[model samples]
Target: MAEPTDTAKTEQVLTEGNEAGVPRRDEERLKKWFIGSIDQGTTSTRFLIFDGTGTPIASHQLEFKQIYLHSGWIDHDPVEIVQTVETCIEEATKEFTKQGHSTSDIKAIGLSTQRETTVLWDIETGDLLHNAIAWPDTRTHAIVHELKNRKGADKLQDICGLPLSTYPSSVKLIWMLRNVDKVKKAYDEGRLAFGTIDTWLLFNLNGKERKLHVTDVTNASRTMFVNLHKLEYDSTVLDFFQLDPQKLKLPKIVPCSDPNAFGSMASGPLKGVKITGCLGDQSAALVGQLGFSPGMAKNTYGTGCFLLYNVGEKPVISHHGLLATVGYHFGGQRKPVYALEGSIAVAGSAVQFLRNNFKFIEASPDINDLAATVKDNGGCVFVTAFSGLFAPYWIDDAKGTIFGITQFTERGHIARATMEATCFQTKAILDAMEKDSGHKLAQLAVDGGMSNSDLCMQTQADLIGIPVDRPVMRETTSLGAAIAAGFAVDIWKEFDELKEINKEDRTIFKPQMTTGQSNGMYKRWERAVEMSKGWVDDSDDIPPSS
Candidate 1:
């Protein structure tokens, strides 16, 4: 099934348009409209071009380095991250033109980024103050402990809809201002600018002239500064961190879908193209799946796994240990949609561990084939708590452990167990969502790298006792941003018009295992999880007595 050539497409368009006797301008308009999306993830950067139907026609992706200066400290070079984005845009644009499509066809662009990765820069010099602290970094653990015990700490979650944790960008910012001298000096001089990855990319993409410093509500909600109800920074939350807004130049908060909030790109292959849509990576995936009404849920299995369930127009403070955050804000008269999110810190990365660290396979996709060799886990269970578990458990002291291993345990069994680890966590999160929202989802929509495996999706369906829906085009994160951009510019005026986008060739996996058998396997996984904790004692990192 080769793609049609440029000559073939041109002929087909002209023949159809002339047969109908339609005006030339209308036909040209149909041929010249497209949307671009910049999907910046935790481990890679991508640029994708989409037509009005939401299919990614041309795209390029680049993986950047993850810097680990110390244990539990993961940082990314802010300069290198921005450069990779520029390169992706240029390369993707070249691909589009090679197919006889002009850059002018791309009417608008949208951006989605890894949320809560903190970056600081000089407002005047435009120089990065330090490396971007990634979301999973635990350097702020000590600070998080201190903040949790302070006065009014219990009220923080009610105000911000997030518990005090090291994942928030505000926590990372506080750690830098106290320890990093360069950041402290800039703050003292009133020249410091702070932002998440979205804000950083927007600043550079707009170039020095515009210097547009802003972030959308989806990204802002993760920073622990924005009030869930007000959609603006909360003074009480800022006071808890002892942050002075006068000293630090924070990015202005804007709606997720806006026509003119984020200015046009100042330079690039797509120079002067307006950026009209933005979302945090997970939120963008939900939009791409068209989870518009209440009760729809989507799970993204990327570097980490996230399950977000729509909680309708108002925020619901989770009593089941989930984070409450904004789903998307279309701006204008539309009310903001809120969601309950469950985050598992390790998903596809565990597969990478077996490939890169353990040498079990040469490529990522090989795990599916390898695991398929075995009928089941062979009484084995792997608790992939590499950096400890997340979501409902939130056990920081746990470590990766394998249980029920005998001489009979083959590599195939281990591989199957590894895949089951993620499925088990997803099931746990779904249960929590059901408790908080009081509605059991009929089916789960899934996307991202790991969802490509039929074995994994089937395992998910069996354990959760619900159908798992996967689309043929798995790049929904990019498509979600493209949808936002299209709506902002009137390329799409209503949600009903998007019903056909990415709707064909979808695969749905139904439960294959019986209820009793699935429940038995899940119970064993829970037992393993409980045993895996308390392995990393508080004093394990301390030097032994001389």
Candidate 2:
């Protein structure tokens, strides 16, 4: 099998052409040696080199600086993200040289990034107007709340398959235009440039001279501005916020993984290598974990816990709080498959709060061991609302609240309960997915940093009453990029042929808790969630951007 490339699915044909869809150079000059997977996330950026089988031959990673301008504000320097990505590629290629291989084998590259973070800048100057406003930033909560009351707010959920919340890009972009100095003035002057992370990186990576401005279908769907059916930026949504479609620059929506959508790296050691695949972090993790068929599911434990269940073809408008999302437009599927996703705002970061905020634990892993020390929760259950609840119950007003603290409750119990908080939310999401899709989860394919925990996996299994499968390689997010990159360059002919590439020792946790125990514990979790709503007052009276 061959490797995956950085091309979008739209660019996967054996034939090649330039941005104008015309052949500017020899199509055969496009190297077919390596595919680079650039995994850009909330905290860090990485560059991975892969072969035909979706295996990582070499990789490098670097964490970037995060700026919190104000409380509830989260931002990233687009320049920093691009530079770190370059450094990662350089470092990885240096390591590759140490392994007695030249960087020449690199064929294509794929990118999976933190979704909904927006970057505004001058199309000519190549300078960012402001830091990237992350999806979780609460600075826009004011606008979110204001819109929640308006008549169109109720209709937004049906059209976009997403609730009118701070998590999406539409509101965040609106907030930037209204609150920021340059963003507002520039938009008024029609000089503003806007893009999600992938678009920003693609423009930076390809060359500032000829802006490579196109967003993959998967990322565009999350922005709320894009019409879910037409897969283009909607004028109605633009008008709802009283914004100018002309000033707010949006990239063309294209397929998820193709070799030529955004050409290869132009400045890195792998400069000539073409990028062929791109996806948001969670979507890439799904594809990387090989959730190819319908009924396939995975829960990525990141800053937030995102649970996705693949539902094949044509979007199923989710009745529940879950978002109807594109599984992938591999540019090969009969039609793009969709997913019912339950996104939780808090997951692994809850443990981080215990370490940095509460000073309860010395390190992150200590929480896990401390959790395992306690046989059970000791009647303590934690509702991780550090960022409020998501999916099934879109309680934007909730804050992190720990409940049922008793005389016997200790750090160990809290630790276990903290981990269980993730599991419980995950179970709720899976339950919601099952309800909406009418498909009970047979098993869960797990990846990401937290899935390494045997205790957490077992807890997830017990709560969800399904088998939890932890892949051998936790880097499935990057590997998925590799897979798409390889597929585009004809290194791998089909998905099944590449299945054995990342095979490793597996861990499977089967449901052990009895139905009665599961029910009673879940009921307690429900009560805890109800109590959590008062943290901010979920009543519609809360101020927008509150």
Candidate 3:
């Protein structure tokens, strides 16, 4: 008889077990199992359904309203966020089932959300007390200033691995307690419930019958309430913030990937599906990129840009201004891995600015085509500090400024400058990460909305002088969540198995600019960044409404 062909072998592996003698039951489970990921981001919420091999089979995305109450104040409706998530899950799962698959095939779900966005509600009635405070909102700037000057405030970094800033949930929560009457009333009555987006979604998804209030370590780490060393809420920090344990209803911090911690969906097309994973959006992107070991790093360019450099099991406090965060904890016997993260407050939002503020283009994708029209930035440099600079600089005083513009400048020049601004900031963050981690990045695994721009990726490669690897599936944020959920259900038994999935046909952008040229451009960018600072010297510039 002729030897079996490759197709026959593949068919045999699909129908029967391979030479490893895997049981038929296991094979059938593997064949039918599907994982779902809810990627709740700053500007949008998306749900993606993936098979056992990590390939997204069905997905749905909804762009929700971003409420900007004031210049630097941002908020989102808590109810809207929850409703949008439910809608996405229902729609995506419907498509999955419509494709001849059963809802039972979706064995597990994972959640990835924008970290540090705080929501407060009533524990008994589940009524949202106020709109969700977005991470980028600077309403807590005064509170942060007060905390910074208070006694023992300086020691917060040592305890929580984070400095007092407007970015964390602790500060946002404090702001709400002091400003919002409803929140204060709830706190006084011992009914105030506090959580990030993940916690809020989990609570609502589990339904009114049995509300589950919990958060993953990755999301909890950004809140400034959890101690990096202890992996739980620290009493000392709580004392410093003057938050009484008797009054506050904080969620329990659980492992990033757990089958039981995040409860099943109470209703929807994916009703009763187990939630096995929860991660901050950036951390989820890192896991989705399979950056499981030390020295591996990934950049996610969503509403903002975040670079996470994995530093292995132990947390390394950044002496270089980066935030130390829990990367992910795969529940079982494994320890949680830590990472050094650098956040850029603006990335794709700069592109959105062009569309919404400047009307430079009708849509975001038009930016790439328009930007490519110009050979370079045309002697223009844009400092995209719309909500101030984050990471190494931390110049909250800076405002968005475009310098080097002349009468000859065109829209293309501004577009190019906008793209370059993000690239320059990313390079700055990478430099800080290198200094902090003592490891040089050979390549960067990138994903998110802005990463879709080949022009932007090429610019990033040229500026950083490293290969930029982008996978065919640019939705790694959702993919990461799916991977975590799949891990819990044994759809993916080991990390080594993920290496074979989603590994084919990657796009690599190589550096094309000379070192001297790149350096010259970056120096000009630095000067522009410096010039943009102190633009808002008057305290009145940021009104009390924020």
TM per prediction: 0.93, 0.90, 0.94
Clash number for each model: 0, 38, 0
Give candidate 1's TM-score: 0.93
- Residues 252-369 of candidate 1 have per-residue lDDT tens digits of 9998889899998888789999999999999999999998889999999999899999889999998887899999988878889999999888888889889988899999899999
Angstrom error of the Cα, residue 162, model 1: value is: 1.1
Can you write out model 3's per-residue Cα lDDT over 1-546, one digit (the tens) per residue?
A: 999753343345444645764422233434556788999999999999887667788999999999998778999998999889989988998888889998866778989999999999999898889999999887676677778899999889888888777789999999889989999999999999999999999999999558678999999999998999889999999999999989999999999888799999888887788899999999999999999989999998888999999999999988888899999999899899999999999999999999999999999989999999989999999998877788878777788999998999999999999998889999999999889877789999999889999999999999999999999988888889988887776666568666755678999999999999999999999999889988655455655574
The Cα local distance difference test for each model comes to 0.89, 0.79, 0.88
lDDT of 3: 0.88
Pairs clashing within candidate 3: none
Q: Candidate 1 clashing pairs?
A: none
Error of 1 at 444 (Å): 0.5
* lDDT, candidate 1, at 86: 95
